[model samples]
Target: DLLTLDVDHLVVVTHGFTAGLLVAAWIGMPVASAGHVAFPVPSGSITTLREDGFFHNRAVVTVGDVAHLVGVSGS
Candidate 1:
């Protein structure tokens, strides 16, 4: 379903563990291989996924970036 979407960019918000699975799926990695992969997605953190050109352009731009929370009281 995700691969069929015709959009230049999309946003997905989900739990940390689920986020890792989504990333693995987006990059065509085997689900089994993702078993050991961990994507740190703390509350309010941001992750970025990008694709460019046509073939083999997928990329993980950022993982759990909380720059905006740098000065937050509870961060």
Candidate 2:
């Protein structure tokens, strides 16, 4: 049922900052410039981007989703 969806959108969330951005760039997607933020995205972090089309625009929905670790320790 998780694979069933009625909406037309694409979501990409992957590890490796450069690799993710590079793949998106290669596909002609507009990507924001990477910055040296004070807090870097930790390991196991999630970076999500959503779009309606594959070869068009995509917007970030959420980054670093740790909700799955709500009741888990050392998350």
Candidate 3:
């Protein structure tokens, strides 16, 4: 596993869906990521409430997302 090497910070830059993002965080490494794509949102799911993977309880770093979408909207 890429995480078995003991990465202190993981930067994932890819167009991955929500499930992929969740898997990345589940890896248990401090994660910093940026992606340009959509994350599936089902009714009552965390993604539905948060509206973005960056909003999840992970250390992912998302650049260029609609800032206003999460109340942290900024240019």
Error of 2 at 3 (Å): 19
Clashes of each: 0, 0, 3
Residue 57 CA displacement from its true place in model 3, Å: 13
lDDT of 1 at 55: 78
lDDT of 3 by residue, 1-75 (tens): 654554454443444365556544553434555243334533222321122245535443432344344553342
Query: 1-75 in candidate 1: lDDT tens per residue?
Result: 766788777778888589888878878889789988877688888889888766758898898899989989987
| Model 1 Cα shift for residue 26 (angstroms) | 2.0
Superposing all C-alpha atoms, what RMSD in Å does each candidate have to the true structure? 1.7, 7.0, 11.9
Q: Which stretches of candidate 1 lie over 4 Å from their true place?
A: none
- Selected candidate, larger lDDT, 1 vs 3: 1
- After the best TM-score superposition of candidate 1, give how far the Cα of residue 14 lies from its true spot, in angstroms: 0.8
For TM-score, candidate 1 versus 3, the one ahead is 1
- Model with the higher TM-score, candidate 2 or 3: 2
lDDT of 3 at 44: 26
What TM-score would every model get versus the actual structure? 0.80, 0.44, 0.27
Per-residue lDDT of candidate 2, residues 1-75 (tens digit): 422566565454555566455445534555453232222355666656565466756555565666766777777
TM-score of 1: 0.80
Best by TM-score: 1
Name the better of 1 and 2 by lDDT. Answer: 1
